[model samples]
Target: MENQTKVTEFILVGFPSHPGSQLLLSVLSSTMYAVTVIGNACMIFIIRTDSKLHTPMYFFLENLSILDICYSSVITPKAALTFSLGKRIISYNDCASQMFFFSLFGTTEAFFLAVMAYDRFTAVCNPLLYKIIMNKRLCVFMVVGSYLSGCINCTIQTGFTFSLSFCGSKEINHFFCDVPAVMYTSCSDTLVNEIVMLALCGSIIVGTALVVFISYGYIIITIVRMPSAESRLKAFSTCSSHMLSVCLFFGTVFFMYAQPGATSSPNKSKAISILYTIVIPMLNPFIYTLRNKEVKESLKKKFKKKGVFFVPLLRMRMTTVSN
Candidate 1:
């Protein structure tokens, strides 16, 4: 970590890498990583190509898919490779780079979720001014602001992390170069580091969460006042995906990072890490798209344009009609 540090590399000793489990873990991790990448990539592509999805909500969603792709990539490929690498060793520089990118994308994503909530609020509570308030320029600015905030967050955390002195070779028990796992290996006293970690993780996770809560509150009130049940259902449907996404994402993240000095067994920590890092990324696309009719329609249109699904069905129906 520092000039006094003897360790030039760290071993990722997260999951059991025994022969039998190694094959299974490698295959499973690789599969999940592939799915996560493809899913998020498709999400971004769909949002980009679909004129119907060019609104602020999907615009923010496009950023989210990008973030999901990035952060998951920061960890997943290395992790899957770990099963095959004889020593599962990662050099100091690589580890640090992983940590920085992971933190940057992860933090930016939390802020973006809050941004999405605010977008939802404005669109729901003040439909008339939604266009004016959430114009493209402001949307781009907010996205850039979130990215800058993430850069600042990760730079500070990564700087403080690798600055500590390590007396010997280290094994990072968790899958990735997560802050806590790296900090845990430092021989130097990390009280300040721990406090700093807690503060930053809390503010990012909880702070964005607070924004989501307030925005949703106002959104709910507005929805409750709507005269038509159909409108109410439509509004609720629009929000349901975001709500589920927020819960699935933030719940595991808060438990994992928000506790600064808390101790957990490596297995438990690994399980939680897998949930947020791998599983959630794979799930988010489905979570967001399954409940959104517009995205579904767009996807169907894409398939139809490609002559994949709907067009074939249309041909079968026309054939029946000819008979």
Candidate 2:
């Protein structure tokens, strides 16, 4: 404990070696970070501004966009700075804060995804009672519940992590202060930490994933029983985008955290982390918009109303002609 107090900061050894590679990575990371912020911001703006999108689905989507923005911001900017400006040191308190927020947002995202799955189930599986089931009060509760659960979970995880005495080197092998990487530096026995991680974190990740899968299973059954092909297609389209996002998020997360630590190569883990932390957020807006005709139409109407339509159309035409 005394030695732990002596340590004031930790060196974040982000993306190990190759200065040239780091520069390239910085450029790419910065570009993705900008896209993530802008794309999610647009989603939020469109959902809020569009009266037609006031349904439960879009409401949950707006929340998801907000989460994506927050979750990515917690890690990406600092990582981009590390790659670009070579600032690799993080204060002990700052590191703990980062871990707490990261875990909070991450856990919230998982629960929110589960709630979104429930929303979809209500919408598709019980269309007649969708409004009654997912009323404003319930929606608000779900969102608030996600945040509260995140706060509780992160508090425990962060407290448990920081309570352990860290000795030897303070070098974290990843771009950000993830639990596994942080624990690796501790001189104290981490069996309890690992067990807690397996029990608490695993329950959150796996439990939410099961909810999503079970919801989708019922959704598929309901969609198949629809009277018309058009209805079936509409139902599938609505859920497909969400399902893809879920798969991308849960797949990468489960890969990183579900297994025992230090078994996978650090570089591989870093690459996976990049996918979930940066690429997924940036891609989510595109995935939801490109696949959903309603969002695209809403966007077109918004842009045309604002007299910004011509620019996007002109760019599209230029790209088409070039191709």
Q: Which candidate should be chosen as best, given TM-score against the real structure?
A: 2
TM of each candidate vs. truth:
0.92, 0.93
Per-residue lDDT over 28-97 for candidate 1, one digit per residue giving the tens place of the 0 to 100 score: 9889989999999999999999888889999999989988988888988888787766457889899999
Task: Report how far residue 145 has shifted in candidate 2, in Å.
Answer: 0.4
Candidate 2 residue lDDT tens string, 136-231: 999999999999999998999899889988778988888999888888778888899888887888889999999999999999999999999999
lDDT of 2: 0.90
Candidate 2 least-lDDT 10 residues: 258-267
Task: Mark the regions of model 2 whose C-alpha exceeds 4 Å error after superposition.
Answer: 262-265, 308-323
TM-score of 1: 0.92
Relative to the true structure, candidate 2 reaches a TM of 0.93
